[model samples]
Target: MIRAFRNEDSEAVVALWLEASLQAHAFVGKGYWESKVEDMRTLYLPLSEIVVDADEATGEITGFAALVEDFLAALFVAPRHQGKGTGTRLLKLAQKMRGTLELSVYAENERAVEFYRKHGFKVVGQGVEEATGHLELTMRFGG
Candidate 1:
């Protein structure tokens, strides 16, 4: 089920992000991801509106999506839960709640680009992220 973020869920959510990020962005060094754990916990997450996907039976969080205003700031599904629709479900929930969503994704992350396109987001612009120095595409849904 999809639900609102809880302060209590922070630990599980951060751990999920680390695991999923390490899996999805294997091109990036483990140390890079590890270094961001603190910022993800204290800085980014606190600034976004977060929602989590919880297993109905175990009540464990399997994935989460974060939104800032109408833009999707982040989404991560546990590696064990990949290809199980957890990320898509969380994104659909975001669409229902916000009606429109926008995001920027790494140009090299083909899987994520395909996923967003499959969900009706279209690339509107491209740029480089100063933080990672990675090429990125800006995509938007619902105009």
Candidate 2:
């Protein structure tokens, strides 16, 4: 089940991010993955909104997603939980709270791009991130 993030969930959430980042690193590079995690705390955590997916049986966090205003800031699912729809469910919850949403994603991460697109996100613009020297695409959802 997906629920609002509690302070207690930080450790699990961070772990999920690290795991997802490691998977992303295979294609995006380790430096880019590291910068993404750094951006999570620096750019998203301060915004004070996140949601976590918990395993019903174990109660262990399986994934997490966060939002800042109308922007979807972070969305990571544990490697073991991928393709199980947890990320999409969390995103739908975020969208329910904010009718519109936007997010920046690394352009090199095609799987993520396709995932977002499958969930109705559309690329609206592109830019370079100074911190990671990676190209980013800005995608938006809703009207």
- lDDT (Cα) of model 1: 0.93
Off by over 4 Å in 1: none
Instruction: Give the least accurate 10-residue stretch of model 1, judged by summed lDDT.
Output: 21-30
- The candidate 2 region of ten consecutive residues with least summed lDDT is 39-48
Off by over 4 Å in 2: 31-43
Q: Which residue pairs collide in model 1, if any?
A: none
**lDDT (C-alpha, whole model) for all candidates:** 0.93, 0.83
Total clashes for model 2 = 0
Query: Per-residue alpha-carbon lDDT of model 2 for 1-143, expressed as tens digits?
Result: 88888877876777688888889646657666666676565566667588889998999998887887788888888999899888888888888889899999989999999999998999999999886778999999998
